[model samples]
Target: MSSPCFPPLEPPALSPETPVPQGPVAPPLPLPSDLSSLAFPLPASSPQAPIPPPPPLPPPPPVGGLAPPHVFGLEKSQLLKEALEKAGPVPGSRDDVKRLLTLQKDRFRSDLWWILFCADLPSLLQEGPQCGLVALWMAGTLLAPPSGIPLERLVQMAMDRGYTAQGEMFSVADMGKLAQEALGCQAELLCGGLGGPNRERVLRHLVSGHPLLIPYDEDFNHEPCKKKGYKAHWAVSTGVLLGTQAVPSLGYSEDPELPGLFHPVPGTPRRPPPPPEEGSPGAVYLLCKQGKSWHYQLWDYDQVQDSNLQLTEFSPERAADGRAYVVPEGGVRAGLCGQALLLSPKDSGR
Candidate 1:
């Protein structure tokens, strides 16, 4: 007899073609890194709860931050050998890797930070519902000079201008306004709701050397992100993943308890993620930062926000023995907000 394996990623979750829901009765979220009044379940006291200010960013440093190199380097590689080495077992084709590489840049230099995600400015991580703010900070600075504004101040600014409501900054229009105010950039709303007509338009925008601040459900299931009370989250999209097999996949080991059998690594991809597509279509993933952790992520954008959602117990949180982004059974399909905003240098007009 064989031990049951971690189940497959739902079909709905798998086919997000390149775009990117629901409820919960879970206890209120903890105030991790200034999350109070910044995310779901709006803070108890009103008149805009006071947010904690983040620590100051260090002066510019000498070398890059991440050693393992969490992001694509300035030099190019079609096979993604480095990322594949660490973020591998799943490999991307040369074309897909090349296409994805076009999105990364040397955003941070000095002591302040290195790459966004893996080696990041610690101060940016200590704010409330600031996932997008970090993404925005990184996006604004990409291929340009770093802005001195602290993420805490930006959050406060957003708060003061009423860009935030119901514990989240849900409007792309509002985010664009804040981007102009904080980073001196112009943000264009590319698409609203995943699978909208402009889904592929995002690709054109990115290739021009700009990034989109997109919203996503924190759920691994990736669909039907809308719930009754709140719109979930906003993260920055560095680029799109075109079915790169270099992404980590389900790692299996023979069950120690049941000899000759196997069990999947708790949180790795289930069903080996529909392999990199030959043309990079049905498998385009967005390289993003959801602001939940220290590194950027490759998430499926080809998903939609309609009712065809599927729920699963197979959340990334399961990897930590339920110590991570866990949600109740059948509730894992929520959190995929389907909108995006493209931020460009206000001066460049790209």
Candidate 2:
């Protein structure tokens, strides 16, 4: 049998930098006379160096002269926890209170998207007064859940839920939604006339550790609105001062000029309403209603300065204590337009 014929072998290609090894050369194989001038392939070049990455971008400048910008995230949860833990048992410590209260402002300053996330509200007063918002925000902080919802998240949720009063005025309904979002429960709303039958019930609620949102009548001028008549405003009742069972009545003066109304000391100048007397029904710690500060340009309900409805045995009359009398006004006839909100969980069954 003929031996197996072998194909001609070519030497392995080497890079130009690699030195060729000295060795005995083999005779070149004979090529067909017809295949003359055969060309050889060139070596491949090294891969081009990798392209460099672009330089990082510079950070954006801070706005409104606020603190450095912060990325919103779960880190806020730690902050909430720290604030609550700092409060300890009593939540009213000045520092703790201030810290919790300022969280909203601090977050607002730190977050670049806060203004936009807040829906760019033109003015808190322009939509609905912030008395209710402040009251609600305060309550939310005090009643913060064990899970620790941040004030920033609360405002964001409020904005998303359309509870921040875009295009319309903020109302009790909006407050309910806000409370529901923050507390994970819908709040209870109380409605009645100022100095109406519900006044006692409101006082009872405040006594039972339930904060009430009552209408505040600003009487800094010392004028009794019942005598002139005015609207009942909104305020949050943090505490209640109980008066004696019997509130002293203003006695009729002999002056013919003022037959119906009782007259105080002659020539007494107009003064701010005095604190409730022993027998007075009671006074509530009305927050966000009467403060004259200009924090957010929100007009407090106290601007109304009076309640048209009055509590009296006979006709509407002022009390003898010389203080402007206001009550949890509620009734179909004349009371606050909004409802008193109670931070309670909503009914899951519904």
- Please provide TM-scores, in order, for all candidate models, with all chains considered together: 0.45, 0.36
Report the lDDT tens digits of candidate 1 across residue range 96-127.
Answer: 23333345322211121101111122212324
Regions of model 2 farther than 4 Å from truth: 1-129, 146-149, 166-169, 215-234, 245-338, 344-350
Per-residue lDDT of model 2, residues 290-330, tens digit only: 22221211121222123423312211433353433223233
Instruction: Point to the candidate with the largest TM-score.
Output: 1
Q: How well does candidate 1 match the true structure in TM-score terms?
A: 0.45
Count clashing pairs, candidate 1.
Answer: 29
Q: lDDT: which candidate is best?
A: 1
